[model samples]
Target: MAPMGIRLSPVGVAVFCLLGVGIIYHLYAGVISSRIAALRRRRTVDLRELLALSVEAAVLGGREVKRAREENPLEKSNGKTKGGASEKIALGDQSSHRKMYHLIKNTFPFLQVNAEERAPAGGEEAGVWNHVIPADLQLVGEGREVSADDITVWIDPLDAAQEYTKNLQKYVTTMVCVAVSGVPVIGVIHKPFTEYTAWALVGSGSNLQPRAPRGGRSLRVIVSRSHAGKATRFIQTAFGNETVVHTAGGAGYKVLALLDPPDEQYEQADVYLHITYIKKRDVCAGNAILKALGGHMTTLKGEEIDYRAAEANHGGVLASVGRDHRALLAKLQSADSHRQS
Candidate 1:
């Protein structure tokens, strides 16, 4: 009405422009968020599928191992003695584990077993056509293989073969560790004989957390429910006299058995203990998940264990559960010295 023309106030113009930009940004953010959520969902689905396939293959492999055991028992009972005599055995039971590894490789041609083809980062490539790089969960999907940058998968076939050969109920076969870098974000342990598994994942949040498997409970160490050694006795003394114990074989099996209870026993019995002192392959994925969920794995010297280093296999691991576990570990160290002396 001022001059029969569209004259707008400065404030009005500023408000309108601001609203327009805000609206545009809001729409863009919504789109981006939707995409991110969709990608996450897809990834979850893919992970579930891959896990299912792995479990299935491992089960089949277990059957094969059982069959082999039945056909040719690893050890035979000595007629002269009531106890069975130890017999020479192969380094590895190569039947089920090796067969499955190659089978998975053959079936999924795109997936790189332990290494993949990649160009060198800086140097000029000459001797090799492609540089091999370690990948996390490189799976062959249909015609293409998906290479995830965030996730990693490590497989240790035949974790407790000695126990398996001995036909110990506690023996575990494959140990799978999922990690981001050297930190294990998830852990899976499968026992061939029982056809059971235990798994853990790093939960969501700013702190590293425990991701329990279906009907799974948090892990607790159980050192030789029956036989107690000097090292184990030292640990028990620190834990307390009433502390419960479970029988398990090998570090890998010991760790897994902590998560899984025998059918005759209770699922999870609450105690003051938490898992620490796990080996490289033993706690690789478990430690990753724990750290991601705000936990830490270190050595008896209170130094962080570097998974990439060869020293990870040397054992003598010390891990803490929550911040208070550090105190317990210190006491255990004292006990260790006492036992050593």
Candidate 2:
């Protein structure tokens, strides 16, 4: 009936129309899926970049603090300096922390950066991250939903304040760490003087930069540069005189030395031991990086340090390259027990 023997019945026309609709539907669905994937990738990148920026900001701000302290030396009494510019030195400890905090907030307005505030928790006033981190935020390594309450951000704008004021610039470090569900997942440490940065994202492994080989002839140990308290002495005694002890500053720097040691006398430290109490801000970033390198950082009893708490770590922290963590922890625990008795 059609021209040149070409003809279409009612059923044939219906089939053709259905095929067209199906093709269109599939194309539309594919476009939406692609867009969603792109958005997720963008978010992950944004979070990583934000963490890096926070560390960088802290480093830059630390320089300002160092200059202020140098310009106005600490007085013999009251620990205050006398000068118009020295006013910053009075607030040196908090200045860097505040600067990094504000920088993150201004740079990324979409992220609800919580202000550090005192709130009532467990029958006590506790400093907590006030904002709720969105659950949809993707954690780099762990494939799990992270609720707002389960995520916390820690910032140490300037570590080794005492060493920094004393012109021991090598020990100073600026660090930022992000923990989800009480586990550190992202960490960044920046040395302002060296301009060297060590960062780690859980499940992504350690930094790929060229680093000196770890392990040496002796059991290399890195202790606190400034605070050599009873804990340090006990660890030294526990390891016996054969161990090589290298004193350095900054918890982050100590961890870095373990990860990327120098080519000098002390190439690397096998263990980073801190016997005294330390704050979450002080060790969170370093511990995260260490864990990424297949290392372990825990208490003398071999328990993981909890980051969700409001208080500091009073028990002690032992970080090792995973070779002899059990033995080292046991030795330290035995020594601690002896001391207690």
Candidate 3:
């Protein structure tokens, strides 16, 4: 041992060991960082596929009618019926929600918790995304950084539960949307009955099949089937009697109708209008698809919906298929002004 050349001292051996450890740690960190970047790049596609699966699960679960009462329940003025026969109905909304949530969790355990759950119940914790960068990532246009905290997933397990219950299969849709820093980047709209799936990434065009031509005779408008209130009627009146109005359920359905209408009898909507407040889950997916098609969705005030806000949208929404947006906005403004005067 004493004859060995260049025998290192104790201090030198410790320094060499430290350097080796440092090198190993650095290499490990680099590998991890690279993996994260790759995952982020493919996140949009992954999410879209996952959403399609989840939507399918929701549709399957929603179709089950356990009891006749679940399909149609007799309404009573009070808890007790005149004949003293009480009935309980199984609501499709809750079952659809559970099915969709569990399907997604079983598929992608990483996105376990719902981002909308501000106060999660016992055993429910926030989703953990290890790949999410600690620092901001570029989203939307330039000069914007989407914080990791801003990333979230919005799901509408059953977009048109009312229609689903009524067996209006065409009106029902399962929607999933991904928002990076509150800006929707990926969206999936799946109709179980028709087996139609429409999806879109922020920069990429929509994957809507059977694309239809836009040229038509009249300015066709699509409005909410269930919640057609005064505001919606006012919008129709403002558009004038010449405009053709179609009633449909589900925000995704309305938007999809604009893209791929059923037949010549049903003309594609030029504008999808909602003149009342709606949850982000209702419109997030539709908005993303519309945007991918070179369309715009904004509030009556011409402001974009802030998905990051606790209340998804404060006012009405106007979604147009590229044309007539500015003209429609001007008419809406004029209508408001006339009403005020």
Candidate 4:
């Protein structure tokens, strides 16, 4: 999900604990809200506004990523850390994720933020965060106003870090996704190298061109270039050897492949598969973007993911575009049954 080698360490735990704000505010603002009412309640939201702010937040994070690359401020961590969990981390990720979180907190401190990089418990000086919101941009249209309590912001400071470390600029991306009542409603993916951003507000519209129609004789499944052992075997077993599995870097990039044809000569993808470990931050933005285009993204079992889940989106993922999602799921199920028996 975060390139093969990169990982979200234990230090990357809930944001609330990092702030040292105590456990009282943890349920609504830090930990996943397991309340049945929180799950069932629906609130009218002007997703357009949140979508805009999220885009700005993503761009700010992208700037930090670029700076980190130029400054070579990358750092690695261990499995045990005072921050939260112990796992290898990047300084670029810390700075960028902090900036993204800082921006949102400054604007609206009450909103719950789910982030990959965990900062210190006390946080930076008062002068740390400064963000500028863009004034004019025709994004999403016509949405009912919603309360801030039901909003959750998801941020991935630097995706595809391994690729970026290797000077693979194209593979690097920064993403921001807004989830409302467990449903991802807005997504923003920004590429630092090209400075290009693609965003979507579900049920509204997007700034992207139409994706290439699904073609080719075999089912084209795009996957992580970093880790493909399981996905490759699954395609071979489930769809037979005729299936084409294209390997690339970053969840955002793979999702982009499903959206449109690459600048190169390769064919567009029908689905993006990750039959392995992946956190919600890894795929939530892509999920929102794909859904905006009228596509499907869910667990391998075809279950909708709750963004506020305590465990995060830990199961394997299967995302299909411009195809029969149910039919694909049905086929996958049949194959699994045969393999087990």
Best model per lDDT: 4
Q: Estimate TM-scores for all models.
A: 0.54, 0.67, 0.64, 0.77
| Candidates ranked, most accurate by TM-score first | 4, 2, 3, 1
**Which residue ranges in model 1 land beyond 4 Å of their true spot?**
1-50, 76-92, 103-152, 204-221, 224-227, 236-246, 260-279, 285-298, 302-304, 309-312, 318-323, 336-341
- List, residue by residue over 1-341, the lDDT tens digit for candidate 4: 65577555667655636666554445334223322333454543356667777888888889988888888845565455331223445567777887787666655556688877455413531222223324433545565476767788888888876677666777778999988888998889998777878888888788765465646568898887755776688777888899988888788888887877234333368888876667788789999989988889988789998886553555678998888889888777777788789
Q: How far does residue 130 in candidate 4 sit from its true spot (Å)?
A: 10
lDDT of each: 0.45, 0.63, 0.61, 0.73
Using alpha carbons, what is the TM-score of model 3?
Answer: 0.64
Alpha-carbon deviation at 227 in model 4, angstroms: 2.8
Tens digit per residue, CA lDDT, model 3, 55-166: 4543443453222225654322224322122322225444555555554444444442353232122232222223331121222223223333545667776666555555
**Deviation in angstroms for 91 in model 3?**
3.8
Give one digit per residue, the lDDT tens place, for model 1 in 192-286: 66776544444422111232432333333444322335445555766665555444544445443323334223223221222333336555644
Candidate 2: tens digits of C-alpha lDDT, residues 80-131: 2111111112235555556666555434433333333321111211111222
Clashing pairs in 4: 10-85, 11-84, 11-85, 44-145, 45-146, 79-86, 225-248
Q: What is the lDDT of candidate 3?
A: 0.61
Determine which window of 10 residues in candidate 3 has minimal summed lDDT. 133-142
